[model samples]
Target chain A: MLEWIRFIFTAAFLAAGIFILIASVRGVYKFDYALNRMHAAAMGDTLGIFFVLIGLVFSAPDIWLGAKLVLIIVFLWIASPVGSHLIARLEVNTNPIWEKDVTAARRTIEEGDTHGHL
Target chain B: MSKRNSNWGNTLQGRFLRWMRFGWEPMDVLLIDKMSQDRDESVNDALSAAENLRDLQLSEKYNADTAIEHSIMQELDEWSLSKGRKIVNRLYALLSVTLCVTVILLLLETVIAMPMRGVAVSPTNNEVSQRYIEEGMEETGAVNIVAGMILDYRAFDTLGESTVLFIAACAVLILLRIDRDKDGRPTQELIAAEEDDRSHEPKSDRILQGSAMILTPVVLLFGIYVVLNGHLSPGGGFSGGAIIGAGLILYLNAFGFAKASRFFSYKTFALITLLSLSFYALAKAYSFYCGANGLPSGIPLGTPGSILSSGLILPLNICVGMVVACTMYIFYAMFRKGGI
Candidate 1:
C-alpha cells in the first residue's frame, strides 16, 4: 500500500512537471509582451517546483530523506520569488513598452489626474 | 560607292579615304572627330560632377562630418599615446596602483587570517550567555533548550541583532528615501507619485487581491508562530525574522508598495529602532551592574527538557525577530519604489 502511494505520488508529480513545462512554452509563444512571458515563467517556477517537492516528500524512504527534501523546498521557496522579482524589475527597466497603447481603465484615470493637476 | 573608293585608293587620296572611314586621318574628317571627342569629354565631366554632388548630399544628410571627426580624434589619440609624455605617466600610475593594491591585499589577508591561527576556544558567555541567564528563560515561558538559549540566555545579542536590523532599516531609509517638497516640508516626491499611481489602480480584481489577502494572514500567523516558539524550536530570531520579512515582501508584491507603506512609516520605523536598541543596551547594563562585577553568573540551567530550560534565549529571539522583520521590510520598500 505504501509502495503504491509512493508510485502514485511520483507519477502525479511527473505529470505536473510536464504540464507546467508545456504551459511555460505555450505562454512564451502566446504572450504579447516580455513582461507577460516573465509572469508565466515565474508561475511555472514556483508552482511546478512546489508540486515536485511535495512528490519527493511522499516518495522519500525515511524521515531523514523527507527532512532533506523539505530543506530543498524551503530553499527554493525563498530563492525563487526573489529571482522572479529581480528578473521582472530588469525587464521593466530595460525593455519598457513605452509606445504601446494603454487598454486598462486605470490608465485613463491616471491620464485624467495628470492633466487635471496641471 | 565601290567605283569611287576603287579610283581614290589607287593613290594617297584612296588611302586617305579608307583611313578616314576606319582610322585617324589628317584632314577635315580628323578635325570633325576631334570636335565630337571634346563634346563627349564635356558630357562625361558633367556626369562626374553630378555624381560628386549626389555623394556630397548623401554625406550631409547622414552627418558624415561627425563620423569623420570621430575617426580623426581617434587617430590623434593614437598619435598622442605613441609620442606624448602621458603614456609614461600612465604606465607609472599603473605600476604604483598595482604595487599599492598588492601590498594592501597582502596586509588584509594577514590581518584576517591572524585570528584563526593556533586559536584556543574558551567558553565565555559574551553578552549572549549573560543575557540568557538573566532575562531569557526566566522571563519568557519557552522550553526548547536552544530556543531558551536564544530568547533568554542572549537576549541582549538578540537586541543588538535587532538594533543591527534597525540600523539597516535606517540605512535603507537614508539611502532610498527621496526628498519631497510637500506643503513646504521636505517629503519624497517619489512617494507622492507612487501614491498617485496606486490610487489609479482598480480594486475590482477580487480573485487576485483576495488570494493575496488570504495569504497575508496565513503567512503573518506563521511568522508570529515562528517568533513565539523560537525558544522551543530550531527556528529563532534570524529564521523568524526572515519569515516575517518574507511575509511583508509577499504583501508588498501583491498589494503594491504604497499600500504597504501605509502600515509602517519612516517616523514609526525610526522610533521602533531607537526603542529596541535602547531597551537592549539598558537591559545589558542593568545585568552587568547588578550581576557579579560585570561577570556573568550562569543561570540555573532548569530541567533540560522543559520550555523554560534555556533562561534568556526566548527574549533574545523575539528582539532579533522584530529587528530582522523591520529591516527586511524597509529594504524591500526602498528597493521597490523609494529610490535606493
Candidate 2:
C-alpha cells in the first residue's frame, strides 16, 4: 500500500512537471514578444525542473542521488533567474522598439507607485 | 513517325488508372481524346512555341538598349535580390530551429519518463548492459562503465564525433574568417565588424562582469575536474568540454574578445585542435591494429577506480576535451566576429 502511494505521488509529480514544461513550450509558441517567451522559458527552467527532480528524488536509488537531484534544483533556482535577467537585458538593449512599452526610473520612489510591502 | 508510335495515352490501362485517380474525369478524358487526335498538331505547336521564344530573344537583343531582359527578371532588382535572400535565410533558420526544438522536447519527455537506474525485468537492461556492467571494469580498467565503453571500447566512434566537430569548426572558419592584408593590418570589413561590436554588444555591464569574475574560475575548475575524473564519474570528455566551453564563453562575455585573445586566439585553437586530434587518431589506430592482429595492447591497465588506472582513456579523454573545447570556443568566436 505504501509503495503504491509513493508510486502515485511520483507519477502525479512527474505528470505535473511535464504538463508545466509543455505549457511553457506552448506559451513560447503563443507569445509574440521575446520577453514573454523568456518568461515562459524561465518557468520551465526553474519550476518544471524543481517538480521533476523532486519526483525523481522519491524514486531515487540512493540517498546520495536524491541529494544530488536536490542540489541540481538549488543550482537551477539560483541561476535561472539570473540568466533570465541577463536575457531580458539583452532583449531590451538590442531591440529599440520596446522603448515605448518601457518606462525607466532610477529609484523606486521616483516611479510614483507605492503599494507593495517589504 | 507519329503513326509508328501507338497512342499509349488513350490505352485501356491508362484510361483505367486515370479513371481510378480522378473518379469522374471529364477534363482528363476530353484532354486525352484531344491529345490522341492532334499528335502532329501538338508537336507543331511546341516547335512554333520555341520559334516564338527565339524570335522574342532576338528582338530583345537587337532592339533593346539595356543588356538585361527586364521582362523576364523584372522582379529581381538589386534590393529585391538581397532582401529575398535574407527572407529565405531567415525562414530556413526559423523552420530548422522549430524542428530541432520540437524533436529535443519529445526526446527529453521520453528520457525523463523512462526508469533510469535499476530494474529486474526491463528492455534497457539487456545483454548489452550486463556485458558492460560485468566485463567493463576488467577490460577498460575504469570505474565509470560508460566512460570506459565510449573511450576505450568504442574509441573510433568518439574519434569520428571529434572529427565532425573539427570539420564544422573549419567550415565556419572558412566561411566567416576575416581576411587580412599582407602587413597583417585589419581590412575595411574587419574594422566595420569591430565598430559593430562596439555599438551593439554589452559594454562592461557591472553585474554580469562581477558574477563572471566570481564564477568563471570555479566553472573552469569544475570542468577540469570532470574531464580528469572521466573514468570515475558520470561526466566524461564531451560534457566536461562543453562545460569548459560555456565557462570560456562566459569569460568572453564578461571581458571582451581582447581579454579572451590573451590566452586563446586563432593560433591557440588551431594548434590545440590539431595536436589533440592527431594524438587521438594515432592512439586509436594503434589500438585498432593491435586488437585486430591479436597482439596485446602493451599499455598496462592499472588498478580500476583510480584516475591513472585507465591506460589510454584518461589521455584520450584529455585530448577529446581539448578538441571539443577549442571547437566550441572557436565556433562562438567565429560567429560573433569573423576571426578569433
Candidate 3:
C-alpha cells in the first residue's frame, strides 16, 4: 500500500512537471516580446524544476539521494530568479522601443515608465 | 535610398533575402512617423539612423573622403557581381557539408569495428584489469579503484592534463587579456573606478546579495570537503573546484566586480594559480622519479578509506582543485570585463 502510494505520488508529480515544461516552451514561442518570453522561461526554471525534483525525491532509493535532490532544488530556487531578473533587466535596457510594448499594469505607473525606455 | 538598397543587396542571400522581403526591420514605424512630420525630414532621419552620414564625414579615421568613396564603390562592385560570390559561398557550404559527413562516417566506422558484446570475455577483462581491481586498495590505499588508478597508477597523465588546463588559461590571457603593461602591471583603465558604468549595474538586488552571502560559505565548505575526500568517494578535485568557482562567481555577480576584486584581484589569481601549478609539477615529478627508480618514496599510504590514507593523492587533489577553481573564476572575470 505504501509503495503504491509512493508510485502514484511520483507519477503525478512527474506528469505535472512535464506538462508545465511543455507549456513553458509553448508560451516562449507564443510570446511576442523578450520580457514575455522570459516570463515563460522563468516558470520552467522555477516550478517545472521544482515538481521534477520533488518527484525524484519521492522516487529516490536512499535518504541521502533525496536530500541531495532537495539541496539542488534549494540552489536552483535561489539562482534561477537572479538569472531571470538579470536577463529581463538586460532586455529592458537594450531594447530602445521597450516603452511601446508596455502592458496595462506597467502603463498605469507613469513614473516607472520613464526610467525604462530612455 | 539607392545606397541603402545597394548595402542590402551586397549581402543578399537565401534567409536574409526572405526576411528583408517580408519587411522585418520595425524601423518602418519610426520612418512613417518622421514622414508624417515632414517629407524632407524622413530621408534625413532614415539616413542618420541607417548609415550615419555625418559621423562618417567628420571622422577621417577610415582615411580621406575618397577612400570612403573607394570602399563604397568596391561594395557596389561586389553587389553588381553577386553571382560569382554566391556560387563561391555555395561551394564553401558544400565543402563544409562534405567534410562533416566524412568525419561522421569515419567515427561511425570505428564504432562499428568494435566487436565486444555483452557478458563476453573481452581482452579488456583480462589479467591487467583484474590485477588493478584486486590489488588497487592494497597498493594505492584507496578504497575507490577509479580514484586509485587516476591519482596513483595514471597520476602522470592527470598531471599532464592539469598542465594543459594551465597552458590553456595562459593562451586565453594572451589573446583576450587587455591593457596590462610591462612587468604585468594592470593599466589605469583596468584598475579605474566603475563610477562611469554605474548606470549599467542593477544596483545590488538585495535578495541576490543576501542569498549569495548566506550560500557562498556553505558551497565553499562543501567543495573543500569533496576535494579532500576524493580518494574515499566519487567526488574529486575538478568537480569540487568547479563548485567553489561557481560559489565565488555567484558572490562576485551579486556584490559586483568592485567589491569582489578587492579580495580576488588579478594579483591574487596570478599568485594562487602559479603556486598551485608549480607545486603540482614538482610533486608529480618527484612521484614519477620514485616510480621509475622502483624505490619507495617513503611517503606512507594511510589505511584505506581514511581521509589521510592516500599519501600524495590528497595534496595533489588540493593542488588540482585550487588550479581548477582559480581557472574557472578567472575565465569568468576576464570574459565579463577585460580586467581581473
Candidate 4:
C-alpha cells in the first residue's frame, strides 16, 4: 500500500515537472524578448527541476542517492538564480531597446497593472 | 554571405542572411585595421608621391607592367576565387562523402560479424580485465576502480594529459596576457582591453556580489570534497578542479580583478602549476621505480573507502586538481581582460 502511495506521488510530481518544462519551452517560443525567455527558463531551473528531482528521490534505490539528489537540488537552486540574474543584467545593459520596454512596464505597474516582466 | 542563392526570402536561411548584417561579436573583427592608422596614411602618401613622380616622367613601361599584373590578378581571382573554387569545393565534398560511406560500411560489417550478447565466452571477460576488477581494490586500495586505473596503472598517461593542459594554459597566456614594459605605460592593446572591460563591466553589481559571497565558499569547499574523495566516490581531479575554478571565476566576476589579483596573479599561477606538475611527476617516478625494482614504496595505500587511501593517488589527485583549477581561472582571466 505504501509502495503504491509512493508511486502515485512520484507519478504526480513527475507529471507536474514535465508539464512545467513543456510550458517553459512553449514560453521560450511565445515570449518575444530575452528577459521574458529568461524568466521562463528560470521557472524550469527552480520549480521544474525541484519537482522532477524530488519525484526521483521519492523512488530512489538508496538513501544516499536520494540525499545526493537533494544536494543537487540545493546546489542548483543556489546557483541557477545567480546565472539568470546575470543574463538579465547582460540583456538590460547591452540591449538598446531595453530601456523603453522597461520604462513602459514600470508605467503600467504604476497604473496598478501587474506584470511579471521585472 | 554564402555563395548559393537558391532560396528567395521565405526560408530560415534567408532570414539568417538578412539578420546577420551586424558587426562581429565584441565589434573588434579587425584589430590591425584599427591599430595602424598612421602607417596606412604614410603608405597612401608614399604611393601617391610615387604616382606623381611616375606621372611627371610618364613611364610607358611602368604603366604597361601594372596593367598586365592587374589583368593577371583579376583572371586568377575569377578562376580560383569565384568560379573554379565552387567546383573544387564540390569535389572535396564528394571525396569526403565517399570516404565516410566506406568507413561506415566497413564498421557496420564488423559489427554484424560480432558475437551475440549474454554469452559466457565473450571477448570482454578476459583474465586481465577480471584481475583488474577483482584485485584492483586489493592492489591499488581504491574503492573506485576507474580512479585506480587512471591514477595508478596509467599514471604517466594522466601526467601527460595534465601537462597538455598546462601547456595549453601557457599558450593562452602568451597569446592573450597583456604585459607592461619597464616604464609601465599601457600598450595600445592594453588600452583597448581596458575600454572593452569598461563597456562590459560598467559597475560592481550588488546582487552578484552578495550571491558570490554566499556561494563561493560553498563551491570551493565542494570542489575540495570532490578531489579528496576521488578514490572513494565518482569525482576526481579534473571535475573537482573545474568546480574550484568555476567558484574562483564566480568570485572574480563578483569582486572584479582587483580582489582576485590580491591572492592570485600570473606569478601565483606559475608557482602553483609548476609545483603541482613537478610534484606529480616526481611522485609518479618514485612509484614507478619502486614497482619496477620489486620493492615496496614507503607510502602506505591505506584502507579503501577512506579519504587518505590509495597511496600516491590522493596527492596526485590534488596536483591534477590544482593544475586544472589554475588553467581554468587563467583562461578566464586572459580571455576576459587580457591580463594576469
| TM-score against native, each model | 0.52, 0.64, 0.73, 0.75
List model 4 lDDT by residue over A1-118, tens digit each: 9899889989999999999999998998899989999999999889999999999999988899999999999888878998899899889867888888767876887888865334
Instruction: State the DockQ, from 0 to 1, for candidate 1.
Output: 0.04
The weakest ten consecutive residues by lDDT in model 2 chain B span B1-10
How much RMSD separates candidate 1 from the native structure? 25.5
Among these predictions, the greatest TM-score belongs to 4
Who is ahead in TM-score, 2 or 4? 4
Cα lDDT for residue B96, candidate 1: 100
Of 2 and 3, the candidate ahead on TM-score is 3
* Per-model DockQ against the true two-chain complex: 0.04, 0.08, 0.17, 0.30
**Which of candidates 1 and 2 reaches a greater lDDT?**
2
Please give, for residues B1-89, the per-residue lDDT of candidate 2 as tens digits: 54632766567776677788879475679787788677788787898999999999988877674545665466676656879889889
Worst 10 residues of 3 chain B by lDDT: B1-10
- Cα error, residue B41 of model 1, in Å, equals 76
TM-score of chain B of each: 0.51, 0.65, 0.68, 0.73
Error of 1 at B126 (Å): 19
Top DockQ prediction, candidate number: 4
- The clash count of every prediction, one per candidate, is 31, 0, 0, 0
What fraction of the native interface does candidate 2 get right in terms of contacts? 0.09
Cα error, residue B262 of model 1, in Å, equals 4.9
* Pairs in clash, predicted candidate 4: none
| CAPRI classification of candidate 1 | incorrect
Top candidate when judged by lDDT against the true structure:
4
lDDT of 3 by residue, B73-130 (tens): 9987887588767887889999999999999999999988776665457666778888
